[model samples]
Target: MKKTAYLCITALILSFTLKPSTVNAAASPVQETAKTSNHTAGIKQEQPGTLEEPAASEKPAPSEKPAASEEPAPSEEPAPSEEPAPSEEPAPSEEPAPSEEPAPSEEPAPSEEPTAEIPVQLLGANAAEKTVTLKWDNVNNAEEYVVFFLKNKTWIEISRTQETTGTFSLAGYGTKNSFKICSYNSEQRQTGESSEIKVLIPAKIKKLQTTAYSKTKVKLNWKAAKGADSYYIYGKQDGKKYKLIKTVKKTDARLNIKDKKNYRFKIVPLFKSTLGTIAGTASETSYKNTEFVSMGHQKYTYSEMCSDIQSLCKKYSEYVSYETIGYSEKGRKIYDVILGDKEADHTILVVSTLHAREYIATVVCMKQLEYYLLNYNKTVDGKKLSDIFSNCNVHYIMMANPDGVIISQTNKARWKGNANGVNLNRNFPYAFKRDGSPKDGSYSGKKAASESETQAIVSLTKKLNKTQTLAVVSYHAMGQIVFGDYGGKNQKLRSDITNMYKIARNTTGYSSAANYGGTSNGNYREYLTYKMKVPSVTIEVGSVSCPVPKYQYASAFNRNKLLILREAAWLENNF
Candidate 1:
């Protein structure tokens, strides 16, 4: 019985071990479970290693059948192992499952966007009153804004602020009032502008009346306009169109006219607050014959005038040196008129119209030259004029800025630039640099002595070695003024020149106004006085309306001629 028991135990153990291996190898869990249950029920197994399979024809006894029923315990143990494998597989696969879900969520988050940026818009502008207002939508990411105003078609930065609501107001934005706006971030990158807004400023007119007592004196007066800072009174005579009679800061109700004649009058009110902005209309008024002399004659064309001068120099070639000093950009010859009986050791240089609009000086100088040449033998104040001309050589450079003159003649309204857009008067070798555009009246050349017109003059002045240039006179227009060396403290020729200037002022009935403010730099006079140490004066001729009207030529001549003649006489007496 012990031997049978031992054999049965071994068979039972083998059966148990083999059952698990078979279950693990099966492809389908259901089939594997069915097979395991059937095998457990059939085998009368003791333990895994002791179990054995039954023979084909063998049959189990009733007692062995009961032992086979215990197979359920082995089946239960395999069930626990299978459950753990399923649970372990899920744990490993969980990582990939979370990754798949997050991708979809990311797409929707990106689709939802932030706010967009806003654009600028301009509202209105009034140039007559010198005011402008602008409006625009608020921009995203904009911390502050800037407004730009347009004057004479130029965009000028006006103001900047941090207000979100888009309303901007500005004053002192002059003629051709236009506006635009821009938004900026902290980095200062400009966001685009709104649509351009444009406006027109209407002109205002102020009228006045004046009468001349005699052929040499005139009194003028006018009522003040609301926005008028100053008044410009103009007179007209037969042959000549209009002449600026006077400029008055104070509003005098009436003025006395010294010259007797038929006079047509007009007025232009100027805005003092805005230097270059706001112009008033010409007043409509006509008066009968007055004491003023009428200037009526066909003025010589540039070519004709130059030819006449050349001819005159040729006739008097024995007593003078005539040379083509320079050529304009348009190839017009510039002549230098030198007169002396002997080689000039001490020279007095006289130049006029370094700026084109200053034609009055050019005319005056030309007349003086003619007067000296024609009446060389005449005596004035018990002195022989010929002897004076013979002793000291006088060099007259007429129309130094020919190109500028041509430009001014062609474009009366905007006639400030040379052919190459340089202000010849400002183009000198000494400190000839400043910030001004071609549009401004004082545009210096790209470099010192850059323009051919200016270079030619400089070269000629430099080449005149025998002559020790004593003094220079340059002429300009508008204000009745005389300005001289302000560059240094030493006033060498101040008293003498001032005395001469006073005499000139007395003769012409013009006032003495000095350019006390040293704002205009790189001027020819400044260079002559400061750098070359030569005494120079810039004589402003006529009134506010430059190239004083043809009708007012007589009054201008009457007032200014004696003064210039005295200047020439003084030059002869002193130097």
Candidate 2:
């Protein structure tokens, strides 16, 4: 029995040993298969061989969990470098979709969409600078803008800029140009266009001049402007700004520059288009000629008086005649403005400005001569001036001592003598008196008829009295008085002189200081009354001192407008 038990124990030991071997042998394939599967599946199989069996034993259920956990490692490893390749593969596919979308939506939109018109505004044209300025609102998607002007029905590009405003030179462009604007994109494609605007480039007036037609009217003449349809005249008086005077279609225009002042005129060429009125460069400022006499605004100069004499002679050539009887000490002509028929039976002589400071009397005589000529056919009192002057001749020695008058006007001095320091009124030959040779104011000459002006007057008076019934009117200044006295004992001559003085006093409302029985001096009135035995009167004008103010001219003119005419009419009727 002990032997039997030993044998059985031995068998049990063999069984245990073989059983472990068999189990180990069976797990070996599974572990190998799992390792092979993990290797194929790209999983890590790094466990030891001894632990392989336990892992292999749980491989069916736990293999899934390990596979899930191991799968993250593989994914994370590739995410560093290789995963981007797969992502980029899909990204390329999506890129085509966006690219295709842009082709249809963005690209074609810029090309096919209706671009709004460019909003352009025309700034004024600078005539002096010869430039045209244009402005426009910014356009969307526009890279730049181009300025174009129409020339010969073709669009010509003038300028290209990115700014909203542009100034273009109109050097070669004409007075009128049609302009338009266009906006361009970065692709160099035109995006927006503007409506055409008509721009007027103002032209310059080349020349201008004014001719005085009357006291109130002036005629303007100018060279035609390059593109002007009309012209506008502007006038300005002393101490005033320019004003629009008139609009004329022709190059010549008649405007009222008015009387009593000097005027400057400007001529502006105008262009009228379908759009607006444009004023061009103005002509140089011009001045009117001496058609109208200066009415006491300033001292009337000798040169101006000489010009007026020539102008009046040309104006009244039919009824007026002039003679340069003699020259003054300064070589100025002594003018005799003769009116009426020279062969008339009666003659009346009106002499003025024998004293230098009494130059205002020359103006009065000229105005009277102009008035008579202007009213030559008009009826005054009961007869026409022509009819009255037909029988009685009237002569005016205007500006007898122009040289001395020039001296007084230039220096504003109270000079009342000839250039030789001779008072012409006291230098007459009829009633001789030896006054001292003072430089100014009432000085008789060295001898009676010593001065050329005195000799001329003396010779003229003697010649006139020989043929006609002569009357004399001597004009002086500073006192509103009339003097008619030469100690003449003849009844008819005294009566005539007194009647003439009465007429003048009544006409001018002046006080008379008649020295009907008084002695004579070397005065012009006395020379005519005492020696020539004709009716004579000395009329003194003005209430102020000599060289009266310009403002006093109106009163002087109104007071003397009819005096000479009335006297001439009386001589024609009675003489």
Number of the predicted model whose lDDT against the real structure is largest: 2
User: Candidate 1, which segments miss by more than 4 Å at Cα?
Assistant: 1-300, 314-321, 463-466, 485-487, 491-509, 515-518, 562-565, 572-575
User: What C-alpha lDDT values do all the predictions have?
Assistant: 0.57, 0.72
lDDT score, candidate 1: 0.57
- Writing each residue's lDDT as its tens digit, candidate 1 over 460-561 gives 666653355365666676576777435376576566555555655666566556634544555677666666666666667776576566555444555554
Error of 1 at 178 (Å): 94
RMSD (Cα, Å) of candidate 1? Answer: 25.5
Clashes by residue pair, model 2: none
Give the CA lDDT, 0 to 100, for residue 298 in model 1: 20
Q: Looking at candidate 1, what is the lDDT of residue 220?
A: 50
User: What C-alpha lDDT, on a 0 to 100 scale, does residue 285 get in candidate 2?
Assistant: 56
Give candidate 1's total backbone clashes: 46
Q: Candidate 2 — what's its lDDT?
A: 0.72
